[model samples]
Target: MALTQEEIRKIITPLLLSGAKMLDRHCPRCGSPMFELNGRVFCPVCEYREKQKKTETGDVEKILKEKLNELASSLPEEIDELEKHLRVMEKIIELLERYKKLEGVK
Candidate 1:
């Protein structure tokens, strides 16, 4: 079985970027490294005679990062609103305490 172009990309791109020493030559079909076994240049990463790929890949990590950034941007506003509510509740508690103190002597 031959690997698809996407499979070749997933395996090779990271290795190249990390500057790993390549032992095999790149495949003519998908640009992935091909290993030679028994004097045969067989590609385990891509089908032979394959053309340029037209498939679209998803960037899930990028989308998640953007969503996190949006959530972080709104967090300060949420914290501010909570702080305002806490201050109001504190004032109400203080007023109730004062009313109770006045009633104690009446």
Candidate 2:
């Protein structure tokens, strides 16, 4: 069956609000509650890892550096994917804004 615009919004609005609440609620790591620190949401334990010193041997550092360079070489592809996603999101936002304007809602 075909759905009306009001029906579609009634079905989607709650789901979107719930999803946003869930995304805003959790830590990316450990799935614990995140606290805002210095304008970033982070798990307290995960943030503490930044203070730990690396203890790599010469051989380990050499291997790590090689792996890092390999990963760095792939960054352009990663950046392209992010740019594509951002473009898609921008289009979605524009469409939503137009819909809201038509609906006479802010």
Candidate 3:
């Protein structure tokens, strides 16, 4: 007996969703290869799911620029700390010179 169209569809639907494409990677749970669905990894057989691929997500240059800006914004605090350290060193140097004079040491 020939299968009805609805019966064929019911059978084929699941197979199509689970079919492995050439671009598919691997299933996170079963170690079987995974297929791509809407840019995310999908393992139809095992029902595994991975979120969108990382490489497909963001602008590299924009990310770099944001990091650089973060670094740049923190520079003043670092410079202030270095300048405070320099002042302490100058005070130590002055005291050393005074001690040398008192001891008649060059």
Q: What residue pairs clash in candidate 2, if any at all? A: none
Please give the lDDT score at residue 102 for candidate 1.
51
Clashing pairs in 3: none
RMSD of 2: 21.2
lDDT of each candidate versus the true structure: 0.52, 0.47, 0.49
Q: Give one digit per residue, the lDDT tens place, for model 1 in 55-78.
A: 211233344446545544554457
Give the per-residue Cα lDDT of candidate 1 at 90: 60
In terms of TM-score, which candidate is strongest? 1
Which tens-of-lDDT digit does each residue in 1-106 have in candidate 2?
Answer: 2334563365435444544222356555655444553455445434433333222233444554565555445544567786765565566556555554644531
Q: Model 3 segments beyond 4 Å from truth? A: 1-77
TM-score of each: 0.28, 0.27, 0.26
Instruction: Give the TM-score comparing model 2 with the true structure, all chains together.
Output: 0.27
Ranking by lDDT: 1, 3, 2
> Candidate 1 has what TM-score?
0.28
Higher TM-score: candidate 2 or 3?
A: 2
Instruction: Give the CA lDDT, 0 to 100, for residue 76 in model 3.
Output: 45
Candidate 1 C-alpha error for residue 62, in Å: 52
Q: After superposition, which runs of candidate 2 have C-alpha atoms over 4 Å from their true positions?
A: 1-77
